[model samples]
Target: MKGFARRQRSVLGVADALRLGFLGLKARPGRSVLSALGISLGIAAAVAVLGISASSEADLLAQLGAAGNLLTVGAGQTMTGTPAPLPSTAAAMIRQIPPVQSVTATAYIDGASVRRTAEVPAIHTGGISVVAAEIGLPKTLDARLESGTFLTEATIHYPAVVLGAVAANVLGINAPGPGILVYVGHEYFTVVGILQPVTIAPEIDQSALIGFPMAESAFNPALQPTQVYLRSAADEVPAVSRVLPFTANPAHPETVRLKHPSDVLEARAKARTQFTGLFLGLGAVAVLVGSVGIANTMVIAVLERRREIGLRRALGARRSHVAAQFMIEAIVLSLIGGACGVLFGGVATLAYAAVTHQQTVVPAVAPLAGIAAALAAGSIAGIYPAYRAARLEPSEALRSGE
Candidate 1:
């Protein structure tokens, strides 16, 4: 009698489990595809958000880096309301600092207005001013001569002057040489060069520049620098900023105004972080909606396949086999969607980067993390349906299907 008894099979082999899992999907291709699509949309949204944000941040950081290590020092009003001026040797003193790369100064010549002709109406000043610049001015500002040459030792004491981009436009002087001249103050200064628009110092755009020596003799014999620009090593910017005011004017440190472009760059980076967080939240909501869709699809599958479950159980199928079958189906469906979503997101990110002229930057973890999340969601959604299918008694399930 014992020899006639049947052998019990408690668990399924890996190959058999996979075959069973795929059978259900193959039987209902349309339903499986629709379910997978929902998950794909969610994964695409998350991946795209991470990719675009990373690329945008990289572009912004690169632009900020282009601003270089620059520091600007200018004069401020004293407690007595007097305009405190920088010392004549301010540039020389700043250069003494080891981290300081180079220094240059410019003095604003008061009551100077440039004009196309001395006959141009005084009221039509064209909003241009005059400044006495040192020989190292262009190097300090990192500016280039668009037309001619910058101030030289021989040209400094003469009537030679350089026009800024805006100043040139204002005076209607396109080409500068020996013949082209613009009236600066009461003197006729020959236009030796024209400078491109300056990014570091925008005020230069609306000002005419002459040599320090010429500015002293013609406009101000007691000429002193009103502003000083300096360059330093990248790591020494903060340390240099703190000691700059005292370095420029040990006598009137309180009256010295010190500023850096790096501060503005940092503020901009902080602003970008806020937008990234908002987009990430939207992506999360999309993923949540996908999980719901998966759960609904799995529930329907269980309800429609009662006959199948009953027949398998009537044979040799166990509860664990049934559960594993449905669970694997869910996971496979999710992975399909996730893979398609990754492809779509990668394409979208590349297209955007090309249009915006920025380098494409995709985080390596984005795709891997997205796939893992999809699998987790699928497994969680499959649990209740798998349990319901496995709990049905074979005779009852078969009869209900009839």
Candidate 2:
């Protein structure tokens, strides 16, 4: 009974086990760092992928929320397969709807090409479209001017144009000024403004917007609107969209097509989620490889430390103590790697978000989950090595060490 009490009292405590575990790692610093690096790489990849994906989704959601109330009406094809035109009064008629907040329209000027200079060939239109826009177009579309000013009531009747973001780039015109002019249709139109990209209306990003009066006088006297854009009260968007086609063209509702611009953003968000899953699978593969590396390193550690294991066993240490020491070492190693990974991932996320002009958003679960995964990998990887170290016969180990 006394001997049994003494043996029980000699069992290793948690602190003692941890101390010995760290001591073992300290003895082989090179191997310890290399083993931890494997885990670090895997965890860093996982955390960074999740962080970046979350940031992208957050930015998309923000854009959707801001523009969700916007709806567009465009003329569709007629039964004869020819282009159908919307009535010039469509914007005014749609504004009469109770839920409609603002309305604007644009007329697509066919056969009208815009060029940087009149000397450039007419065939090199750079895929740009010339559109006749209302003075209220920028406000209705929620677009911003990168430089200069938008079309005003006083300037709409003159040969003035606002270059869309893409149009400005294609024309190699960075800013709008008094003398900056682009050849439109048969004449030179002074550039009045340069617009930033409009997320809800990509077509606006590739158009050279001229006012309706100038378009009518210079391009076509009987020009009809090709598209109408409107904003509705937040809660009334669905109802407004349902009645928009009928309201825009009472003669033929089917000839007017209605679209909610936010739907495209929602689809893109779904696609990003699917791609995130693929990236997570790749991260998992990396983790599995790291686990293998840890297991290999631990098995080698046990083999190389046979003499120490035997000395401890031949003294007062029990098999369970030996196992606990090895297990703790693995957990601690992976814990270190996880901490470093989290730090690296956070920095990477911030840098990427800043460069891409996206909002930074890291899910709280990402770092916690990464640490937990590392611990789990460590626990599993330590099992076989710990067991093998504990199972060594003291006598045999001592003989082999000699």
Candidate 3:
């Protein structure tokens, strides 16, 4: 209500409000810092959560986007997600679909052991379609070499293997140099090549990858493919889904199953909405307490300045002027706290990302949004106190101590 009168004072514009706020902060540096701390904590928590959310989203998209029109298997309503079966004959027939760009079967190898003499347990091993080298894995793996190259179409039929960075060192496939022979599963297989290190997931520590056909035919017939990756055109996705038996059924018709990012994104958004509401509620509580604190301070300031107010009224100053000064001071306090909160909050986000090993990435607008929110909340919280200050009668205020 008194905002216009507050703005009427050229000497008490936003610039002056800022300057006087600094004066107030300087008056009680300890209290000012403590007040700012609450806001800082609130913003910091929001920033950290936002950073993690962004990382999760980016990681998902990165993993999925790499497919380049590819589709991975869906777990069709079982105890756990399982890879559906598609025989070589059936897969070859699925290529008949107009939208099908490429088809490949991938199987993850669990409890796999490659022994030259002894066995090292708990290594991640899997075989993907031969096309995985062309599309799925990174190009750095392409540059890495040992005695041979990454497997090809011919190698799928032959007994060839590529060793991961860990595998090459542990088995002594290439000792201080080039090619050496190693035995995997009692079969005399040469270590055709050594691979650059690749992560099964960035979160995990160790794993290995190989061709699925090797696991199925040569390694263990009991071994089953955990997934199949397929690529299709953008417009063809709907068409592909119609044929692929993504749903649970005994006599499935299609060879491949497709999943889209939009479905996952919607689910994540719902989860995020829950957290966002929680943080907003906590922030509201903090700001409310801070508002109460400000109101108490303003009341004390007015009581002490009662005589000064009367003297100003006698000198022809308006009641609104008195109210404006008190209100501006309160808002000024909040604005200062808000700005400090932004700085500390930013530091918190950076520290968390560094400690967690996730990427240290933040949205550019978060800090700005935080600061704006702070100012808006402060202005709103100051209204009632400002109104009470404006309504004071000069005569009564002058006689207060008497």
Compare the candidates by TM-score and give the number of the best one.
2
- Give all TM-scores, in the order shown: 0.70, 0.96, 0.64
lDDT, candidate 2, equals 0.90
Per-residue alpha-carbon lDDT of model 3 for 73-170, expressed as tens digits? 43233335554554434444555667877654445454445655434332422221111122233331123443457667666555566666666665
Error of 2 at 80 (Å): 2.9
Of 2 and 3, the candidate ahead on TM-score is: 2
TM-score of 1: 0.70
| lDDT value, candidate 3, whole model | 0.55
**Model 1 CA deviation exceeding 4 Å by range:** 2-5, 26-31, 60-68, 80-93, 96-98, 104-227, 235-239
Candidate structures ordered by TM-score, highest first = 2, 1, 3
> Which model, 1 or 3, shows the larger TM-score?
1
Rank order by lDDT, top first? 2, 1, 3
Instruction: Tell me the tens digit of each residue's lDDT in model 2 across 1-402.
Output: 665654453579888988988898899899888888888888888888899999998888888987889999999987788877898889999999999998999989999999998899999999999999998988888899999999999889999999999999999999889899999988998999999999989999999999999999998999999999999999999899889888899898888888889999999989988998888888778777777878888899999889889999989788999998898888888888878888888888899999999988889999999899899988988999999999998998888888
Give one digit per residue, the lDDT tens place, for model 1 in 1-402.
Answer: 777868877678888877877887888899888888887887887788788878988986775665568889998879999999999988889999999998889999888888887888666878888999888988877888889999999999899999999999988889898889887778688999999978567789888999998988898899999999999998998899899999999999999998876577667778777877787677667766777777788788888998998998899788888888888877777788888888888887898899987889889988997898788878887888888888988998899888
RMSD of each: 5.9, 1.9, 7.9
Q: Residue 151 in candidate 1 has what lDDT?
A: 94
Residue 371 local lDDT, model 2: 95
